[model samples]
Target: MSVVAVVLTALMFVLLGPVAAHAGAGPRDTGSQPVDSYANAIRQSVWVDTGLDGDRDGKTDRVAADIIRPSEPAAAGRQVPVIMDASPYYSCCGRGNESQVKTYDQSGNPVGFPLYYDNYFVPRGYAVVLVDLAGTDRSDGCVDVGGASDITSAKAVIDWLNGRATAYTTRTGSTTAQAGWSNGSVGMIGKSWDGTVANGVAATGVEGLKTIVDISGISSWYDYYFAQGAALYDGGPDELASEVESSGAQSHCSAEEQALRDGAPRNGDWTSAWQDRDYYANASKVKASVFVAQGMQDLNVRTKNFGQWWNALAANGVQRKIWLSQTGHVDPFDYRRSDWVDTLHQWFDHYLMGVDNGVQSQPMADIERTPDHWSTDPVWPAPGTAATQVGLKASGTNGLGSLSAGAPPASGTERYTDNPAQDEDDWAAQADQATASKVSFTTGTLASDLRLSGGGTVTLTATPTTTSAHLSAVLVDLGPATIRNYEDGAEGITTLNTRSCWGDSTSGDSACYLDTAADTENVQQTVFSRGWADLGHYDPSLHGVSLTPGKPYTITIQLASTDHVVPAGHRLALIVAGTDNGLIVAPSTKPTISVDLSRSSADLPLVGGLPALAHALRGGSGHHHPTATTPAATPSRGPAAALPTSQAARLR
Candidate 1:
């Protein structure tokens, strides 16, 4: 037995006194199943020094780490790799489908670990470390939002596991604890904010981190809270910081929170505060292979988060894989439970355990074509995909226009007033009406199946009559299909009362969790992707600029990424408007904007090129049939209503 591991095992025995032995659950003598003695697992805690006095308490802050590992004394000489999930939500909100929180005994030892990570992986010879970010839980620090404080709080633990940082038995104790049982191989996994930390840490080029599974995670804080120069919500950084800040932060974190507001002004210009938290800028330094998953319709974290980061990583030649779903901001375990568990297990075994699993040989991307319908793409965005510009030609009547290939031959102008009362639904349902809140452009019917992959951009040439204006563009599929009702549930999945258990169980913690089902809706129109930009920030620098009342300036609004196939007979439409109701912050003034039709266009990323569109329009029925033909139930809203109040991570 290795000396260090032997001593650790002796200490565990001394502390635990005695334990009842049980075999890994299953029929005996049938097969070589993985063994995990759940009841005997070593559950403990350590305070990792972050080397930062974020609270200004004159002492370095410490992040609380709850650890669970196999207690097999027979394998005393063997060191284990780690699976870590670090998050600020550990103490405030919750994790997984059930919103499970951490529980501890009187002596501060962790009694219950949230999620199935510990219950499943620890029994298979992996150590699970759940970390409470420095600002929350039992840690001592102030929340810096997505700043250095958040990244370092997680990174310090990875450093400690690799013998590069220090750990203590207690928050204020001098007694040191060593990670002698670690082999220094780590794989980070999480959803939302937790997954985001994995991305940030991997970007640090951290040595021990071999892989990260980032699910519906963010790459940039500014991009999430704001787009280009437009604020996505009425609230900003200060409000988000307060949501995750520890109670102790009342004394010291106020300054940090205030600094966040000062650094990133509400005007939506990019600043150093956002730059400091951007992991995509440092993606070239990432050594860890990444597995990313996001909803094509995820409005909260937004598909742009994955699109931008994925492109940068691919450009840098970083190894990667992906999953593009048709749902919203929900975890895969809640939807694709069996497949997720199996694939994740193989991923960890291959990366962390050096197992010769063929995880790398599998398909590059798993795409949900529709609810419960999946297909694997050898390369995401589909091969041979390219950006095709579709011209917006004003019809000169009925508040409608034609979306044709290439630029318009003649110049024309269309105008609309900024209407906060109207949304995408109103624009779609009242296209021919003279409401003036939006301009609708549509393609002819009977086109061939047009498959789109990746993000698109909307360019408009117009002059606003007000000092400030906001532009919103949406790409809607005007066809009938039964899709996941993301607007009905918070994350598009309804958590049912029924339960199913995976892995081992114990008195304090169990692998059992509530089942979930996709909330489906049959609709004639669905908004696949939308984007916004502040018209005032029209300059290339994206800094605020004064708008001359009648001077025209060209601006581009970036649409979120998505993959969808618009079948024959179903027309595609591009709707442009100002002040997108419940979404973005409305314009300072209700601007009556003139859109130059000759210069305005929507660039779409499509597979099979121009020939495909021509073929689709040449006359043929759609390749598929619809589940229902009714109009949409809720058109203007997004898929976020069903999320339980307590489980809202709000930001990635």
Candidate 2:
């Protein structure tokens, strides 16, 4: 052969030799591809048309997507699954541990990507796609704020990946683009707003969506901004929509912004607009298995969001896994660190790559007991737990009362005036027996550790002086202790200047992140869980019932779900008040409320026997063994037998 022919043959051997050797290799056989090698990789951006004119511009809106994948598999005629994260904050707020945003070159192609997903998964033989939701980043249209456009925009990308939708090289549809390397199986993962998009898309029952990992995500947009018809935040949907959209002339999307405001009215009631954004209502359409993680103490997204969504998924028989924590809005990376990476690696391996790693066989739920401490259980709330009602009785001349197993006092009532200015701390700081703005009820030091595994209900049979008033119920743990101050930061992580590396780094991305330490605070008492309801919205949401001048109403407030251990010597207290200044938009008029001691009680979910506790309380005994059957009620006077037989029967 001639020298030129020999040289061409050598070049062919160099390119085809490696591909021939690993022709039959699958993701399961090789685990993840080597991290350092990217000789066979593809990085590009595409615009997916969502088939919607969100801003009424007479043209369809397009979603912006930046993709990074192992080109070796494609070059060798192999198809790979995808791991996608659809986020609206990519341009404005960024994402992940260090809040890194996507950087583009002068030609408008992505040069720098945020977070560790691309760096970690791209080398693992999986394609990673980071998408900018429509109306944010480089995408077209207006921010609909979790409406039809918001959800469909992301779903279109999944369709395109599966070869069911159209995509283009430019927003104006200059040239066609296709996901030729994709195998049609996609797993979506994200935190907060990004995760919300994942949930919304999954609810659409998109064909190619195999699974989703939603972290600190909202299931209902209405719940995020309001609580039982009470506004929890300053701005409504309109303000938030305008805030998250790409920074530009406000007049461009003024009409769309006004529509969002009109949809979410100032009264904070559920409207048709909210119904379109409620993922919980449409969870039955989900075909994908779900992995959820949320902080039990997260006041931002709130625990109710996860609890309701989980319940809906369970009712619909959707496969699911959960991680419940005591920290506030946080990512698992900052909370569990190394373990998160390993578990996530396994999770993606199993769901996206079809690897049988026994992840599905493990416990369904993992709960954080305290900072850095965790326990795994087969199910949340531990399955066999029962609801036990603890009676509230008039204790002393002071307004404070007692929480006990026995019945409440007959014909006695405690009164309080609504105070909109008092926050949680202010309410807890006031002398329990002297506060007129709230009524406090406390149990004596516990003889044994009492564990509360689920949400609690505070039922109040009371009469309000006004037509409408907001009620706030709080469960407090009164004891000196050190606890994670989740209110301070995500997972209570205090960011330090020092950096720590967690994974392999690339030219466009770094695996190192700023070191973070748990933020712990010493305190005498902490609010375990809280609930709020506008008195007018007692019957159902959006439908308010006017109160008669002196008529009594039975209002049941469902507190935020939680898993906590009220340790030995710690007192469990329940506080009843009007308006949580820090959480709710209080009613304008201050109303006087009278709670009947004989009728009102707090229902708690306890793991132990309730009758035995009641028997012990009645007999004035300390730490008696619980009986399997219900204890017979003994005839007594005062508060011991003050609970009406009919009411007690209703409780049972």
Candidate 3:
């Protein structure tokens, strides 16, 4: 631990005392009244300081709290609102960089930050209480991620302020004993990790939590750390955990950090470990209203994760609202403060103060950047959208060609070699893995406006020249100047199988290749939603005129995610490669992939509604079953050959 952590931890114990008061369901009621209803109205004058009690050997301690007495108006029966801002880090040790003011104004602050708990809200009818979390800056106990320790800290502060029979509360309230009673509605607010803590507390069935505001905070580690068949480290090794902890001038305690440590990079293991801290598992027990704020450019907390949390809450019939803004990981308090403060006040007013502010009847999306400003829709992507699947059929003299309704099986096969030994160090860079072996297809002028707004998957009816081969399908949106990489919503992307694997060197088939790891029984698909930072905003009209007789440009769409608006003039391009980029490891260094077009095609489910249409236009759902191709008649069963150990792996 650093020097700051040491001091803050000590101070935390001196102030808050021993929070772990092992209470049983007995006669004594440790439950507290609403802080707003009791603490502020009664306390005549008060002093506050950091609360820290170390060596959880069951010892009580305290530090003075920042106290305030009622002004002249409080001499009457009028009750004032009291607010407490719990510190995620220890107070004296950690420097509060995130909650402080910025040097410059133009450089926006973080997203959905809650900063008015003490300075602004308290003096004006609100009394505030702020405590440092345990084992960080000024608090005690071994830190736990969504653990009992976090709930204990919250309960300790609430109980202490409301005069619940706590050892410290009695001693601290001696000076302010002449004050009247106030309500106990202390609305908790925080962003990112702090918001994550608030969410965890609510899920713990804590009483009087009132309302919660989550900004770019994912409900689960699975979605945040690993998303849609892509290993995060596959992009590059950045100390993600360190980065999160170092923010706000406070590093999480050693125990908390260990609780969130990532293990080996296998999907099965990663998903399993994530299941332990599954935030959604206990969401039904949460009794407070929630307000979620999402940043459009939040690379860590992907938009899909935010959507998942919002959708999950809605699915479980929980009361919640989501706000999407064009910001990054910074506290919204620093950047979009107006929107942040307004929304926070509205939410607190409705839930905490019982004010009918009409916050519930507002639009779901107060979308930034667009001219409309507020595209009010019941759900994401406003309704009435449709998806048009642009087929990638073999055309022209070579295997590469233009789009056709269907194409006959070609006699020859396409071969390529994938040497896993030759790994591209730059994970973010497009390696052009299929440069040696790929068949390209281009579409003619699109008949109507084509917009790709969803993640996609690919299913290739392929046979391996070697025992197994890696297959990658990509959709590219070609522009006039440079290729507009519009496949899935992700920008500046290339190649399919960016983070998955295929191929089997042991199975020898020189003419055809099979992806041993691919789910042949079920179409293999990689769904991409959110996390497309490299993709450029594709607008067909901006790229210049449409198909003018002889000049038609092609936009490449690989097996990736990109959002683009393809105009009538531009062409849609699809590329099939024997190499799957970095997504998956190939089975063979030298292998061939033969495509059976008669058996494979992109089956995009077209439906009305923007969200649905976006899903369809992106296509590549890998659920390709060629309705036009007839299935071969089954022959009589014969004696089975001895199963090879690798056969099960191949059948995967």
The model with the greatest TM-score is: 1
Query: How many angstroms is residue 279 displaced in model 3 relative to the true structure, after the best TM-score fit?
Result: 1.2
Question: Is candidate 1 or 2 superior in lDDT?
Answer: 1
Which residue runs does candidate 1 get wrong by more than 4 Å?
1-33, 73-75, 431-434, 619-649
Model with the higher TM-score, candidate 1 or 2: 1
Predicted candidate 1, C-alpha RMSD: 6.1
RMSD of each: 6.1, 9.4, 20.3
How many times do residue backbones clash in model 2? 1
lDDT of 1 at 186: 93
lDDT of each: 0.80, 0.76, 0.41
Ranking by TM-score: 1, 2, 3
Q: Is candidate 2 or candidate 3 better by lDDT?
A: 2
Report the C-alpha displacement of residue 246, candidate 3, in angstroms.
Answer: 12
lDDT of 1: 0.80
lDDT of 1 by residue, 422-502 (tens): 677666655434456777777767457888888999999989998888888988888788988776655568888999887
Error of 3 at 256 (Å): 6.9
Shift of residue 387 alpha carbon in model 3, Å:
9.6
